[model samples]
Target: MVLLLLVSLPINIIFHKVKLPSVMGFIVAGVVIGPYGLKLVDDVESVNHLAEIGVILLLFVVGLEFSISRLIKNFIPLLAAGGAQLTFTGLAIYGILSYYGVPQNQSILLSALGAISSTAIVMKMITDRAELETLHGQTCIGILLVQDLAVVPLILMIPLLAGTAEGGSSSVGMAFLISVVAVTALVVVSRLLVPKALSWVARYGSSEHLTLLVILIILGAGLASESLGLSLAMGAFIAGIIISDSEYSHQIFLDILPLRDYFSAIFFISIGMLLNLSIFIESGTLIFTLLAALVVVKIAGAFLSAVVTKNSSRISFVVGLRLAQAGEFSLVLAKIALDEGIFEASQYQIFLIVSTLSMLIAPLLIQGSSKWSLRLFGAGDETAEGPKKSSGSLKDHVIVVGYGHGGQNLSKVLNEIQIPFQIIELDGESVRRALIENFKVLYGDSTRANILVQAGIMRAKAIVFAISDFQATEQGIKLSRKLNPDIHILVRTRFAREVEELTNAGADQVIAEEFETSIEIFSRVLREFKIPSNVIEQQIELVRMEGYGMFRGISLDAENLRKFSTYLTATLTESYQVSGECWANGKTVEALHLKALSGAQLIAVVRGNEVTADPDAAFSVVAGDVLVLFGRHASLVKARKIIEIGDGACEKS
Candidate 1:
């Protein structure tokens, strides 16, 4: 294992730097080291097992980001586009196989395999390009999800069609019946049980535990499906879909990502191990013919489907061209078909040749897709428009990039406070939501200068970049600072290592979620151990003060530290200040009988520079005093009205 890692390390590095897929590099390395080449690794089974883990992790993360609500909203297009693609592609392949005089069972299996595109490769490519939030990307994912779901029945039907498994026709009938039952049960269980189970797990707050549970679920589901005469991959994919709605999905993805990377590397390597170069050299003409036929059929089907779904000509062309490549699961289906005597060895060889060539050429096809699309759709006549003007003036308004969870939460708070803000989002659905909510949101890429200008970055009070991609966030910060140096730029990051880069790019505040979560967890642990609250507060303040200027040269002093501490404690203690209404607007704490009715103590009142500490019981109330009160939870509730009604009065209780 160590040797394998050592050998593959340089190849992986080179591929990454060259902007090529790492899995492609892994396969190349595998081919060089396999029996047909250098003969380095002989145990293919172990490598395959390792690679399978990567597949699970990849799919799990994909599921984590799959929003069912978004799918439902675009269900009609998804069904139309995806269904048409599958039907046409399958039929086209079937026709080709029939012309070649292939057996009926073999033709169906081959056609089904050809109909499916690579969920793994397509998703990885989209994610690498940082285009997963775009309309085209979402459409691709939705179509891929439908295809992945279809693989379940296809796998179950394989054994029956091949006559390899027991119970004959009854087995085929049972398999179909069982699949329907399983799918329905899965939906019901996902709706009723998964959420509660995930919630319970989250309450425990152990990421490692959650990750282990996810693995178990994936493997367990896969095994169960296999026992019911279905594909393990299908089960794993379904398991991913079920957990996609869970709140812990993100964390689950993060935890399993490393495993997925390792396994996917192995999976590609295993694919390389299966290839016999000698046979390819001998059957050159036949291999080339099969490959050409596969690409033509698949691309034609996808293109027709894309057009039928009402996508732009360019989008349809790109989708068709991109999906011409055969996928990983196609190999599995071919193997099953061969083992069941549905396809002869030569036919299997043809399948392998076509699939391998398709995989190898996919990147090139994708790269040329835009050019091809332009040719297909007349140049300069693309349907998609350039950036549009924002509703409001950009001056002094907050510019928010990325309308993800963190950005959404921030927007909500800003809305409540009536702060002028404009959002830049790539996702069409998110952009639509923002517009419907009467927000100043523009659909554009934040990394582009024009997009930033459209969002009013020049005169913006602050720019909050909550994009998940580190590179994009850094680029946005750099551009925003160049556009307007005086603007306050806040960035969100997943790791502390990204903090310095964002800071160097001119971010005023770099909020590292993981770092913050760590601090929060440690603080909770301290509290659990019965640490003194004041001591904990002091420690937290000290750490913040020391680290404050490390990124942006801002520091917290004693006064500010005290204020933060008070704010934290107030929230922790559930004590809040509510403004006084017309009835008690002019009354002092004593006159209002606050102590008697609410059992609350007035700690201090600040009116501009005047700080009245522990005012007398008979002190007359003023309209504009900023109240700093300390009280029981029930007392704070009773005093809510008194704290909310006064003019120029803000709560810091």
Candidate 2:
């Protein structure tokens, strides 16, 4: 295992750096180290044992991410796209096999194996592209779920198809019943016991206990499934689904991810080890012929399914290509069939080569399929639901990079004040969110020059790099400057050290998170000390000047600067709503004397969205009134606490 890691890690990393999928690298490493090449690991028994556990864990993680609620909600695609994809793909293969004089039972089994698409590959592609929320992406996931469920039936049919199991149809039905019962039991146990157990264990805050418990549950469920004469992976998936909505799901994911990735590499490598180079070399022409046929059939089936399901021709084509590959389950089924003497050794070897090669090339195909489809289909727009964009006349617009928190706030204020602005967000989901808010957001990498141009960077008044990724920010700043040298380039960096680098990259102002955070901290301290506003302003300006002139373009006196800086400080004029039953509700302003009690002066009382500025001391503080108060952090907390106290409850106590 250690030696396998030694070869696999560096190779995968190298492959990833070259824009190739890491799985391919692991497979290559496995092929080189396996008996056929170096004889380092003569047999795959130990690796396959570990590999099975890896597959279980991998599927478990995937199940955790895929909520059952999501599956139910997306049932249309599950039934429509999934049924079409599987039926059409299977029929095509089965027909071809029958034409070649293959037996009915073997042909049916082979067609079933060929029809299943790789959930791992397609899911990874969608995740990497940040497109899980897209129409096509969701469709793919729903169909994949149906197909995964179909695997149980397919596996059951294997023994029956081979005529080796007793009781025939009854035995098959029994296998499915056991699987369903085991899964239900696992879910019930998880929903009832796991969350309670996790909560109890979490209170102690022991990482060791939390991690151990998670591992125990994963393995326990897997073993239980196997004991019930079902696949271990099936049980682990059920366990993951049960824990997905638990409070500790995120933590459990964090705890188990590294192991999943590592073992996943081993799993793929073990797959590669199954290949015999001599056989593949002898059957290269035949192997390529079958691979091409498989690819064409899978793509056509998926595309037709998606099209019939009302997905755009372009989207359907892209999705078709995305899933045009034999999945890991297909390999598992083929191997099982070979072991049961349902497949000849030569036939199994051919299937292995086809499956491996299909998976190897799937990522690359998915990457380029959109562009390929757009060219072939000549669809008017790339996205069916994306926002309509016409940036031809965009000018003097503020360009905000990243649609995250800071960017959202900036864009919100810009919209409220009627300032024209455009957002550049790489995440398709984020872009969709921004579009929902009516922001003119484009979905593409801001680091790309063309994408920036699409955002009207050349004609924009200023560009704000609000994203946390420093490298991408720096590259964007450089490119933006080259495009519009006079455009005000403002950058936000997480570190003070990067400020100078950002300035060098052509950013006019660089606000480092650490530096600005310190300013906020000290300014609050000064406010608490009742330091003169002028002195604090000078201090902040001096620091900013020394740290790369971050707070620029604002020429303000102490008072105006103080007002602006208050927005950044913890002590500010913030509003607190007085709910019914609160102690302060129905009380007179003089009776409460909020300024005296909490050191928070209520400047305005807003009732039913009507603001009474500087209401008299006798003004009644009624429930549903929003009190805009000004005070330090501690005073605000105290004021909020008083407002939240039930009417007369405190006095009665």
Using TM-score as the measure, the top candidate is: 2
Clash number by candidate, in order = 13, 0
Q: Which tens-of-lDDT digit does each residue in 262-352 have in candidate 1?
A: 7777777676777778888998898888888888888898888877776655566678877887887778777877877788898787677
Off by over 4 Å in 1: 1-6, 13-20, 41-54, 64-77, 87-111, 122-137, 152-181, 190-216, 227-230, 241-258, 282-324, 339-344, 360-402, 419-428, 440-653
lDDT of 1: 0.71
lDDT of 2 by residue, 570-637 (tens): 44666888888788888888877677767878889899958899889889998889998887765665
TM-score of each: 0.62, 0.63
Report how far residue 276 has shifted in candidate 1, in Å: 1.8
Q: Give the Cα-based TM-score of candidate 2 against the true structure.
A: 0.63
